[model samples]
Target: MKIFNTQTKRKEEFVPLEGKRVKMYVCGPTVYGDAHLGHARAAVAFDLIRRFLEHEGFHVSFVQNFTDVDDKIINKATEEKTSIGEVARRYALSYLQDMVALHVRRADFYPLATETLPVMQDVIQKLIAKGHAYVGDRGDVYFDTESFPAYGKLSKRPKQEMESLGAQDKGLSEKKNLKDFALWKTRETKNEVGWDSPWGYGRPGWHIECSAMNLHYLGESIDIHGGGQDLIFPHHENEVAQCEALTGKPFAKYWLHNGFVNINHAKMSKSLGNFFTIRELLKQFTGDQLRLFLLTSQYRKPIEFSLDILREKLPLNQRIEAALEYLERNLQVAGLTPTLLYNEAYRGDYGFAATSTTDETEATAEENTRKSLVASREKFLQALRDDLNTPMALAELMNLVKIIQAWNKPPEVKSPSPSIVTIKFTFIILREILDIFGLYPRDSGNLHPAVTHLEKFIDAKLQERTQARKKKDFKKSDAIREELNKIGVEIQDFPNKSTWNWRK
Candidate 1:
């Protein structure tokens, strides 16, 4: 598998650092607010990466951190007359709920900034002892950016150039240089929650939490580290300096950053009044449709979200939804005996793999058509290997849908014979492929407990009407049916029993 390594600034074949046990870390949502569509893109993009790696038989340990302690979370807490922990807890849960709604699997471990205070402090003290960090005049710890050579290697921006040119936080005091950011910040107000550190009672800086958390969890050299590209500056750059200067180990093997998410080509921000939360957008599209729209663009490029484009994404989602409903319904109603393990006759070795951990081998003539389908899969996966090219991957899915639509409806479609296995693999294999894409069928007939209750109520009323009719109580039977019809549930009294269906 090829993965784009940000450290090398190119797409390279992915060889796991520790022999196929991929240790991946992604920067997760800040707990101050609800997750947005931009968050959805990053979350799902990495989710796809994890899903595909596991599909290829790799044991991947994906870790994502929750920045629960930050200026934003503290500020939000103050605004709501609540504790910072409350602010963090409330939205962290909300973010997880939104992720579940969007079909993003939970990370293997979710480390929080507040919970890792000791870890952060340990890292800060090490940096201080190493002469790479120092206590500022007013009880704050700052990283000495000038002390670390190759400081700008990741960002390619010289620290000297950014000295005065760099910016500092509001009310945040200047360190020795503007480029030197806070490793530990003092709590100015009494209400703010902070820890008693060697410098003072304060909290860790924004960048330091990730550096400390990652160092504690994934160790110095991690297989992958990812976040939005906008964070490449003071945030990620400082993290590199803080860790490398302390541990003297490569901070991360690969640095993967996602591009911006614009709203109709306009930048989305709270200041601009254009930011929409993921929960808010959920009202607009189903989880699957939103995933499709988010993946339509490559992660390295900006995604411009607009209603007009979103409307276009619906048709693609509809196809998946239609198929999902069909598959689930068939599973429910079709009582076919389960088949035993057998070698598939499909030839191309493309599409969805048939059930069985059989060895991948040459496909037959029928498998050949499936192999043609493999072209699309190969192209799709190549796009991913090349820096997670989601747009290219989506294009492949579009091509697959086209093939499914154009497929010849044989009288009775069956698995291909051994000689023809490759030819017949497309349909089945594509389902599995799409499933990894999080676009496979979902049970459409599922309803709330209330809907089931309503159905049962209608059924009871229908039964009563059927019994009345059987007794020749014409008036009672008519009244009973009329009562059910008023509630928009239609009943058909068949010879065997009373049948009911929801009103269209």
Candidate 2:
């Protein structure tokens, strides 16, 4: 696998520092507010990378941190007449819930800034001992940027530009250059939340929180460090200075940063009043559709968010779900059994191998279709390997859907079987690939408990309505349909059966 390292500005072969065991750290939210579309974009992008690595048989230990102690959290607590910890806990849980809605697997560890205070202080003491940091007049520890020669290596900006950018932070004019960032800030107000430190009572700076968490959890070095592209500047650059100065080792082997998410051609930000929270979008669209829309663009490219473009993904998701449903409903015809471990022994293969019962004669008879399926699978993996080109991978997924859809053009008609084994293998490959992409059949058994119960109720009501109509009770049938419609389910009636779906 190859990754585009932001620090190196080139795609390089990925080799973990500790063989097959991968240690990855991603910068998490500050937890002062709800997670917006931009937050969802970064979360989904890294989730894709993590899922693909696991698919390739690597044991990945992923850690994402929550900055629970910050100026924003303090202010929010004060404004709400609550404790700082309360504010942090509320939003931290909110972020986790939003991630669950998006199907993002929880990180192996989620270190918090408040919990890692001792580690941050230890890092600060080492920096001061090494003469890389100094205490200011008002008892704040500032990282001496001038003391580190390779300070701007990660961001690769000139010293003057770095100084100019740092000036925007309103730096203290005591004992250091403008580029020198705070490792330990001194609190000015007694009402603000802070902890007692060697340099007075204050909280950890934004950048130091990450460095300290990484150093304390993942050790002195890690395989990959990632975040949004916006953090490539002063945040990540300062982290490099702090970690390498303290440990004298490379902090991470690869730096991967995802791009921004724009809303209707404008950057999505709270200041601009254009940001949409994940909670709001979930009310109108399914999580799978939202995830697919986020992956429509490559991870490194900016994606435009608009209702029109988002609506286009619904049909794509529907097509994929429909294909898998067809495959499952016709498994008996293809002489296949239902089992997820069709190729459990093929652990490292691209796609799971076909089941043992696949007929060799039928496979030989359907050579052309089988070859097409194999080629599509190869291309799909190739796209993911080449810097996680999800757009191309999704295109290949659609190709598989097209082939399956072609077998039944009119939707109600079943054409001649290409090959029973071919059909079986295609279904296996499609389901496995979808799992790799984190997409699953919504109507399958993966529904939430509440949703599952609701679906069962709907099915029971439909069966009752069918019986009523069979007995020529038109009034009872109409009443059941109205009841279902009141709960946001639309019923479609055919001569022999009725189908229902959530009303769009």
Candidate 3:
């Protein structure tokens, strides 16, 4: 597998430091507010990478940290008149809830900044002892950027350029150099959140928390370190300097950064007043639809956020779902159970098609379809392996759906055959591929309470229509169907039974 490494500015082969075991870390959210679409984008992008790695038979130990005690968290706590811990916990839970709704797999470890304070202090003391950091008169400690000769290597910016940009910022007058960043900030007020450290009562700097946690959790060196592209300059660069300065080893083998999300041709931000939260988007689109929209483009390409784009991609999800449902219905009609097909497909024992001693044309078509299935499966896997090209992978998935839908349209078939078995195999392949992208919906067999109630209500109405028709009450039955139609329920009648679905 190959992935684009931000540090090298090229796609490189991915070989984990430890064979067959991958250590991946992605910068998670600072729990100060609801997670916006930008957060979701980062979360989903890494989630895809993690899932793909696991699917390729790698043991992936993923860690995504929560910045639970940051300036934003402290400010939010003060504004809400609550403790920082309370504010952090509230939003942390909210963020996890959103991740669950989006079907993002939880990381192996979610270390919080507050929980990793001691680790941060240990790293800071080492930096200071090695003369890479110094304590200010006011009990603050700043990293000595000049001490690390390779400071600007990760970001590829000259020291002078970074110094010029850092000089314009306020509140760093005590630093020896403009490019120096804080390792610990001494508490200036009683109300500020802090912890007791060798530098006095202070807190870890924003950049130090990640460096400390990454070391404590995944060791001094890891396979991959990733975050949004915006963090490449100061955040990730500082992390690299601190880790490499302390361990004298490469911080990570590969650096991956996802692209930004834009709204109205501008980057989406809370301050911009155009940000949309994950919860808000979920109200309008299913989790699968949202995942599909996010994966429509390459992971490192910026995506434009708009309802129009979402609407266009939603039918893709619906089409996949409808195809799966059609497969199930056909299986039932042919007296073939999903379990039987599942077992056969799992064993790679799809029975051969009927002999063509009486008809050669039908045999030829079956052979062609079998070949098509094998080709589609190979293409789908190849697309994912090629830097996780989800757009191309998704196209292969749609092709499989078309093949299944075409096979399902028939006059009548009394019994199941190898042809039906082929359809089931195709269905299983598509389902597995969709799952790797985290696009599969939870089984509807476990319905929400509201949906369960609605289903019962609709069943009652259908029962009433059935009773009226049995009694030859044509007028009442027609009235009942008309009422259901008015409420956006479309019913289809069969010789033996009836089914209904929501129209809109």
List per-candidate RMSD values in Å: 11.2, 9.9, 11.7
Return the candidate ranking by TM-score, descending: 2, 3, 1
Per-residue error for 59 in candidate 3, Å, reads: 0.9
Worst 10 residues of 3 by lDDT: 442-451
For residues 6-93, what per-residue lDDT tens digits would candidate 3 score against the true structure? 8889889889999999999999898888889889889999999998898788999999999998877888788866778877776787
How displaced is residue 489 in candidate 3, in Å?
Answer: 36
Which 10-residue window in model 2 sums to the lowest lDDT? 347-356
Per-residue lDDT of model 1, residues 1-504, tens digit only: 776766677777777779878888888878887677778888988888888888677888889999998778778778866678877886787788777777778898999988899999998898889999988777788899789977877877765666755563545555777778888888776556888888878888889988988888888888888888877776788888898999898888888888777986886755567887777776666677777788888777888988788898788877755543433334334442111111242323433554332444543443455555777877877766676677778788777656554442353674223322332344445565675687634522222234457778877787788788889999998898788766545777677787876343
In candidate 3, which residue ranges exceed 4 Å CA deviation? 332-363, 410-418, 442-504
In Å, residue 77's CA in model 2 sits off its true spot by: 1.3
| Model 1 alpha-carbon miss at residue 305, Å | 0.7
Ranking 2 against 3 by lDDT, winner? 2
- Per-residue lDDT of 78 in model 2: 80
lDDT of 2 by residue, 206-316 (tens): 999999989988999999999999899989999999999998999988999999889767778766879888867877877788888999999999999988889977899
Tell me the lDDT of model 1 at 259: 74
Off by over 4 Å in 2: 171-175, 332-365, 411-415, 443-504
